[model samples]
Structure formats: C-alpha cells, structure tokens
Target: MVESILGYSPVLRHCFRNVSGKQFPRFQVIKAQAMELAKEPGLCKEKERYRDSLVGLKPGSWPPKNRADNPSLYNPLARQERMGCGWLGAIFEWEGVLKEDHPDLEKQSWLALAEEEGRSPPPGFVVKRIACMKNEQAISEVLCWSRDSSQLKRMALRKEDIHQALQGGVYRFRDGSREFVNVLTRHKIPVALVSTRPRKNLEEAIGAIGIEGVFSVVVTGDDVYRGKPDPEMFVYAAQLLQFIPERCIVFGNSNLTIEAAHDAKMKCVAVASKHPVYELTAADLVVRRLDELSVVDLKNLADIELTEFGSTPELEMDVEEEEDDRRPPSSAAIGDGFW
Candidate 1:
C-alpha cells in the first residue's frame, strides 16, 4: 500500500517494514506523510490562529468569556518571554550552520529518486520514508534504485564530489547565528552542536562557516545509535557538557528535534528558519529569526517556572494522546520471553 502511494521500490519498502517495531516507534512511514501534509502553509496558519484564540481566552474558564470584556485577559508574548527566562544552556542543530546552502536539497533528492523510479513523486512531502531514515540509510536507499551498478562505481571513482559537496557547498552563516554565538560566548554559556550529519561532514560545514571553535561540544549522527525524536543525542550532549537536561535549551528547525528535547525534559525554542511556526507548536517558544531572540530572553527563560502558566489543554491533550498511542507496550505486559 505504501509503495503504491509513495512510488517506493520494493527494496526501499523492505528497509522500513520493521521500523515501527524498533526503538524509535515514532519513525513510522505513514506518520511521516501525515506530518508532511499537516505542515502545509494554509493548514499551519489555521492551527496557529486557533491556538492564539485559545491563548486569548481566560484560563480554565468554561463557555469562554467574551473577548471584548476580557481585553486584558491574556498576553501570549509575555508567556513566551517568561518561558525564555529559564534557559541555561543551548543546543543548536546544524541546519543553522549554513544560511544560504541548498535550501531545497531534500526536494531535489526526492525528485531525483522519482526520476530513477520512473514515476511522479507524491505531493505534500519533500521525501517519503527518506526523512525518517538516517543519513547513511537514506543514501543507500537512493543508490539501490539507480539504473545501473555504474552509478555506485562512479561514486567510488569520484569520492571528491562528496568532499566537494560537503566543503564547497553553497552555504553561509545564518542571519544572526554568528552574533548569537558571540553573545553566548561572552556570557560564558555552554553551547553544543547536535547534528544528524556525519562528524566529518559536520566539521567541514563548520569550517566552511568559520565557526569552528564556537561550539564547546559536537555530537554527530555517527556518535548516536538513534537520531532526532529519540532524545539520545540531546541527552548525550547534555551529559557531555555536564549539565542536566532541564538546564539545557534546544534551538531546532524541526518538529523531531522539539519532540526530542521535550522527551529529554529540556525546553526547546523553535527557530522558524526552515519550518513554519505552527509546525513547531510542540516547542516552548517560536521565533521567526535567531536575531529576534536576545540574551535577556535567554536569561529570562532560565528563571521562569513553566508550571505557573499551565499547559495549553487542548493541544497538550492531543499530543499526549498521540504519544500514548505510539508508545510500545511495556516489557512487563509482554512477559519475560518477549525480548
């Protein structure tokens, strides 16, 4: 069914057949497609407006009071400002490493795959199961569908293309990434780079951006058994920096990273550089640009108590229910021989 819908080859489908039963149960193929659809600009804006309306309503008020009477009732920006005060450490994802790099690489890659498969790609998502796979796995899957073995042989013969793509790719520092790093450094805050890219590629990109020494610690895809939405990478990074997860704040451009941070008991600030703001509602706060956030906001985030504001009941309930449905059965429920 998935292959027919997504135009995935039998070999590619086989690779993901057991993914849902793995450690990362959230990495299901169908869910990735659903997520892609939910991120459509129109749907995203509608959801945001709904959330904003809820935020404007009086807390715990039934039947919801009139907005005209409760004009001073809610301040969403103030809530975000308070949440920002509690951030002690920051974890940056590598999407922020290069500002002007191939913004549509995923789209292009998927289009290339579609061409190889001799079918039109599905709409609403850049890639099918490719987004859920690790960097190495995604590459292998693409190679498997190529027209001939020479494609692999050619890749072996010209390894420099890989290096050149990594080192000489069209990329630059994001609008205020350099300034943000400088501010963090001056304040003596610990900053770590947690990226899904391989260590060598990450190093080359960092070097290309000329921010080599900015990060105190770097965690790459090669260093982790599981990737984003697993919490392992972010947790490991926190441990390496000698800070508890709660003391760390993650800056990410994807829902996966935000979910991972929340799972690790860390606060996340969604950077809407690549994704829309509504798509990042799982994050503690969302900002249009990195420069929009300041040192004051960071300091404020570190001090605020999240429980005081209370959760967005409707959204939180939905997220919790979804997580519960995805959670694997407990070991005790399966008995001693389950493993």
Candidate 2:
C-alpha cells in the first residue's frame, strides 16, 4: 500500500515534524482532535475534517499503519540501496571520474580512486569502521566523538599512504547544476553547498558548471575538521555565512548530512535526490526535489526563512567569468562581482 502511494508521489515521502498531544505522535494534533470530534459528531462532520488542520499533514493522504505496513522495505529503511555503493561504485558505474583536474580537491577522493585502481587502499582508507547505530543515533555519536581530542588525534595520525591517497582530480559539473545554482542565487539567499564529497571534486564540478561564485561558501569534507554525522561542517558553513546556526537552513539528500544539520541546530530540509524517505526522518521537512523550493517559499518557512543577511545580493544576474586556480565556476558569473 505504501509503495503504491510512493509510486504516485515519492516526494511527499515521510513525516519528521514534531507534534504534540498526550495521545497522538508528535505533530498529529489534528488526529487527536478528530478523535474527540468523533465522540461529538454534532460539532464536526467527520474525523477527516478535523485531521486536515494538523501541521505538515497532507490533505488527503492516509497515515501508514505499522502493523499493516512492511517496515523492511519501507522507503527510508530501503534507502541504503540508493546510496550508489559509495564513491568507488560511482567511479566504476560512470566509467570515469566525476571531476575534472582541480588543485584544491580534498585528499579523501584518493580512496575512491585507489579502489578504482584495484590497488590496495592506503592504511588511512583502511581506518576501522566504528560500529554505528542507526542514522539518528549515529549522527549524535559522530558529533560527540568529533569533540574528543583523542578522536581528532587519531584521525590526524593516519598512515602516510592514507594521506597520499587523499589527493585526486575533481568532478566536472554539467549545465543542470549551473541552472540550479543560478536559481538559488536569484532567490537572494546566499547559496552554499554542504557536501560530504571531497573538496577536490566539488571544486571541479563547480568550475565546470561555471557557477562557483553563486555560492558564498562551499563546505566540503576538508573544510570541516570532522565529517558527518558530525555537526562541524554545518557549523562551519553557518560561521562562514556569518549567520546564526539556528537561522540557517540546510538541504541534504543523505542521513548523515541531515543529522549534521540537526546536531548543529540548523533547520534541515531533506531532499530525495538519492535516498528514500524513511532514511531522511532526521530532517525537519522532506521534499522530492529542491527545484520545488523558491525564494518566496523560503520566506514562509518559519523554521528556516530568511530573516536577514548582512549584505545579501538582490535577485539579478550580470554575465561574466573569472580565472581561478581550481575548477572553473559552474554558473554564469555574477557581473556585479557581488561575490
């Protein structure tokens, strides 16, 4: 039944909004109200009418029942299937690297590259995979451990081969990313990409698309002292924007990224660009595509609306490009040099 609904509209995936009521799960206030109304039919026509008032509830969608729904194949639970088998998988599947030559790519992509080379990964890539709980718990744990001096020390002291493995070329972006970045920039919300991808590929991709200037900041794996599910990247991004962490909103397609934003106290909006819905439960809101979001719509997002920017640019584009050491910017350069 859930699959049938998902087939029709996969974007309206799952709910994560906190609801209140002694009786209903958080965010199901209207259902609780409807039950009361059911006992007083004279006051309301039906439970459906009362249920419509709840926040984040779709108008006509029925809530899933745990007993009736299969949890194993649930969208969120099954999202692991969509992670594309990590960087190595993407390299082999695409028959090529995802990036162009870049000077500042993070050292991490070397792991993916070495795997592609069929050579033994450096000892750093062989770092022990710590036992992790499910997404939500892992997020909290990553944050807690990142703050430890011991963990940081261990990460910094990787074998020399591992450090050598971190170097690599970067990804080249297609025109689609440029258009998307343009849309984001025109909305007057300074755009920034918070990615777990190594900085090298991100730099290459942004340069290829020609829109690197659109984003005021790019928080890559190297930018943060720790990666997701640690909040370091999110917090670093917030700091770069000079915005309060709570005032920032993040869009991520992964559980780790969503958890990072949550841990940082930033508003998190998850997109189903890759993972399924259930995997994104940690986010405050979920959408199937980021193109659905508009600057005007963002203004209405109370949890993440733009209250102010110190000197944010208004919606306008000036066409131009500039030279740089890394990958070329992805979108049309902002002519005003606002960046």
Off by over 4 Å in 1: 1-87, 96-98, 110-129, 137-167, 304-339
The 0-to-1 C-alpha lDDT of every candidate, in the order given, reads 0.63, 0.44
Model 2 over residues 124-165: C-alpha lDDT tens digits?
Answer: 322222111221222225323244555444443332234334
Whose TM-score is greatest here? 1
Best-matching candidate per lDDT? 1
* Candidates in order: C-alpha RMSD to true structure: 26.3, 25.2
- Give per-candidate clash totals: 11, 20
- For model 2 the local lDDT of residue 50 reads 44
Q: What's model 1's overall lDDT?
A: 0.63
**How far out, in Å, is residue 100 in model 1?**
3.9
- Tens-digit lDDT string for candidate 1 (202-296): 78877776877888889987688666568999999998986666668888877877788889888889888767788889888898777778877
